[model samples]
Target: MRVTITLLAAIFFTAVSYAQVAHNNLFTVGIGAGLIGGLYDGNYPYSSLKQHGNFGLGAPDKLDGELVVFQGRIYQTQHSGKTFPVDDRQLTPFAMVNFFKADKKIAINSALNKEGLLHLLDSVLTNVNGMYAIHISGKFNYIKTRAFPPVKAHDHTPLAAMLPLQHFFEFNNVQGDLIGYRLPSFMDNTNISGYHFHFLAAQKDAGGHIIDVKAENITIEIDVLDSYTVHVPPSRDFEQFDFKKNRAEDIKSVERGDKKQ
Candidate 1:
């Protein structure tokens, strides 16, 4: 009887450990389906992002500006090519956030171009199937980014329709933080399957969705988010939108670059 009790205790402890690790997975505020479905409403407030974790990236309600949270600070960039500090009173329709704890840290030794930098990150990944919240900060030789402006209330304009109105920014030989997420390929149906990154200059005055980057002597920190959580807004447009139709092409175009309508 003593031996049986010991075995049971060991098993119970092991199961609890596993559950705690799994609970560390990523927490999402809303589904990307809302974006693909054209449900742009400011339902989730900026305070919600604060609750999920300290480091993450997201857009404001009505796609007003680009948002990046680092070290518990929220940064916003408007379409006027201006960046500023953000407040919790702001609302968000969609955002991804996590309590950032580094699972691994790697020092990039050589100067890597955009493609090479991406390859380096992929090679060091501890789990190909795990969701990762990534941060890269250091001297960047050059970086290109763009921010989306806010739309009027009840406009109901699809994101694709707002592409032409996006404002682009370019920085050379600057230091900043690259806030990003790496989702599994299986998530392509609801989110951008690969890497999605946002940028904020060290000065906290300029940054946006990362387009291209070049740098060296960088430090990359990655946090393995093993759990997934999503909150849906109670907006009517989101409720009535038909996500059954395929919008992968539209999503890809807006996320990357637009070639066709």
Candidate 2:
């Protein structure tokens, strides 16, 4: 009877240990997915309207802005502010961005398949827009608008070095024409209408040396003026949506083997 009881206890403990390992693995995978999707959603930039040259007609400086452009399409125009407005006339952009050495392991040993992972990413992307206001908080300064530091081959090891402050633009499920849309105009005009996203990477090398800690923030405000005429509309406020307490915490509880209350 004593031996039988010991064997049963051992089985129970083994099962618990296995469960804990699985939980940790799932947590890691979820965190990775969150980071990737968040970064991807944050990088889009707004095109600034610029006066290339005066049209033959006595029109003021010909102000023009481009809509979404692909990865390498450059929009180099002189603008006063860090944020620019994207014209609705421009085409919706599509591009795939890859972060080097973000993931330490190549093979993801999680239950999430490619389709499942993409779905999870879509959910994350959907929640990000217009949901939270971004405030710059970190070491890197965007005041200078400095270019990203170059990457070296030696910086390939796990956490060898974090990528330099980086930013990119990504647009998904974009709708509406680029030219017909109009933006809000204000008398004071302090508050900018658009989305600005930021990301900071923290990495630790194999030697436990902290390297390549950086932050990248991009602001892409959609320009309403280039697209449509203004019509004064009644004010309607937004409802507060909380995903952290609802979705993130629920996933955490499941991984921790705690029953949902």
Candidate 3:
């Protein structure tokens, strides 16, 4: 009788542990091959909006528009500075999402620039090496954002070649949210290691990948990730691309948006 009771208890504990682990995993569609290879076509299978979290970020298939998953609804902002609801069935080449339940919240009192703010966030993390899902909501003194249009069908353009084609926008005294991730340095090969963020204006008329930001009196919420999953593309190009070479310079250029439109 005692053996039977212990067996049941062991089974119960194992089931609970598995459930907890499943809840903490972050879901991703596609790898960072696009960053190195510039093969921007979205090849990953389309995942349902219902499967992901209330807040997420991704660009569309073939690198069409910037996607912001706000309040459980997916919105796509194009280079024309227009925002539209994305169909749930739409696919993405790269995306990271989780059920954004904030584990901590911090309020910014001073007007810190983007670099300063990122430093502050880094200081607050208990484990600097751990992954975090970051969401900031409030008023921004000014923000610079950009979105890319889909590449020409006949063009073999890579991301570095497409930066000059992106549309840039600047907003002053705007209210909205920035959604993204902070990954460890070791994860650089698989993702944007430091901080990657996208902006969506509260008015829903403007949004895109964040180039720069200045804000005060904002609430920054963070979800310390316990798990991460990456889905690779099925394309042969991605499989054969040379990720061994360091493309940090190229990525830095894209992030800076140094090319004048």
> lDDT of each model, Cα atoms only?
0.79, 0.21, 0.78
Q: How well is each residue in 1-74 modelled by candidate 3, as lDDT tens digits? A: 99999999999999998666645667777655464356666655334643755677877777776888877778
Ranking by lDDT: 1, 3, 2
Local error of candidate 1 at residue 164 (angstroms): 1.8
| Shift in Å, residue 51, candidate 3 | 1.4
- Residues 1-261 of candidate 1 have per-residue lDDT tens digits of 999999999999999986565447566676786664566677877776787777888777777667888887788887776888787887877777777888888888678888898898889775778798899989899998988777777666777777888888899989988999988877765666678899999888889998788977789998887777777778777777787877677777777757465
Per-candidate TM-score against the hidden true structure:
0.88, 0.16, 0.87
Alpha-carbon error at 116 in model 2, in Å?
A: 38
Question: How many steric overlaps are in each model, in order?
Answer: 4, 12, 0
Lowest lDDT sum, 10 consecutive residues, model 3, at 43-52
Regions of model 1 farther than 4 Å from truth = 1-23
Tens digits of per-residue lDDT for model 2, 1-261: 999999999999999986443322201001211221121111112221111110000000111111112221222211221222234243111111111111111222233322443343334334322211111222232111111122332221111122223222222222111101111223101111222221211211000001111222322122111111111111111012121322333322222223345
lDDT of 3: 0.78
Model 2 quality (TM-score): 0.16
Give the range where candidate 1 is weakest over 10 consecutive residues by summed lDDT: 18-27
Instruction: Kindly indicate the candidate among 2 and 3 with the higher TM-score.
Output: 3
Which candidate gets the maximum TM-score versus the true structure?
A: 1
